[model samples]
Target: MSNNINRSLIGNILKSIRVEKNIPMKKIASALKVSESTVSQIETGKNSATKEKINEICHVCGCSFDYKTDRKKMIDLVLYIYTQYSNLSTDEMNSTIEEVKSNSFISCSYVRFEYYLILYMDGIINQNNEDVQLFKRILEIGKSSFSNKELSIYYDIKALEKMYLNDSIKA
Candidate 1:
């Protein structure tokens, strides 16, 4: 973990895959010959993971790190969308929205959650009912399965949905 290595997307992706494989942090720490605290910090985005560290983590979690594949592409796409969504110009934003809307590639729940989130944001920004309905369907799929980070986004989207309906005060 270093101060310069970006966290968030990569960290969450690592954590998500590790969780999916049922690999504990202690095990990953042992595998990487690092302390559990270091692994925990890396996973929680408090610290950062270098490329070598990311490879080791993906290896330990049995996740493919090959960027040529669709899984990797989708992960990168989601990461790019998540990291750049706010800074995107209107034209770039619309392009991303169209790209996401036209595709149905979901390799994992984390991706699915993020995909729906982009749609949810697009729905809010563009007032699109189809996107909103899709977001509701995703929320109904699972709340317990999401990571804490994803859960935070879920709550924010839920609140926004309520606000959109003018029922923010209700359950």
Candidate 2:
């Protein structure tokens, strides 16, 4: 992959889908006619796979390979849902959240962290919960792996969450 391409982001997406679908690295490696270690390297962003190899990995994992655009759309949707929280009805908001969660292409750890952050911001998820802790851990561990936009969202939401919690405690 070129230096311009976000290797870790792509790797995380593929790895997430693979693990979620219970598809083994060996299976993807076999499909790509490569060794399991090669698949591991690709998934960990230690090595890059060609576009054709990525597509074959996706095919083996039963997902489509339109992630570049899908990822952007998913981020846009999350931002829209956050900004338009009051304009949307309860059902609409719930439906939108479910849509994001169900999208196989949007399974990157940073994206998932952003999703959970939005949910916490909207009061859809409680502040004290396993989901929040899990995503927070993801953010901390993968801080270097995330994009600038994603990190911006994380810091913004975290500040907002802290302010809101403080106000609630004072009340």
Measured on C-alpha atoms, candidate 1 has an lDDT of: 0.63
lDDT per residue (tens digit) for residues 1-171 in model 2: 355346765566567667656788888888898899988888778887678877888788776676444445556766666555546465676777767666535443335445544554444233444366455544554455545765676666676566656754433
TM-score of each: 0.44, 0.57
Taking every candidate in turn, the Cα RMSD to the unseen true structure, in Å, is 9.0, 5.7
Clashing pairs in 1: none
Q: Give candidate 2's error at residue 85 in angstroms.
A: 4.9
| Model 2 collision count | 0
Error of 2 at 44 (Å): 1.1
Per-residue lDDT of 1-171 in model 1, one digit per residue for the tens? 234333655566566567656789989999999999999888777887877888888788765454333434444554455445556566777787788777644423235455666676677656777647646664444433445655665566567667888997962
Which candidate has the top score in lDDT? 1
Off by over 4 Å in 1: 1-5, 66-171
Which one wins on TM-score?
2
Please report how far candidate 2 places residue 49 from its true position, in Å: 1.4
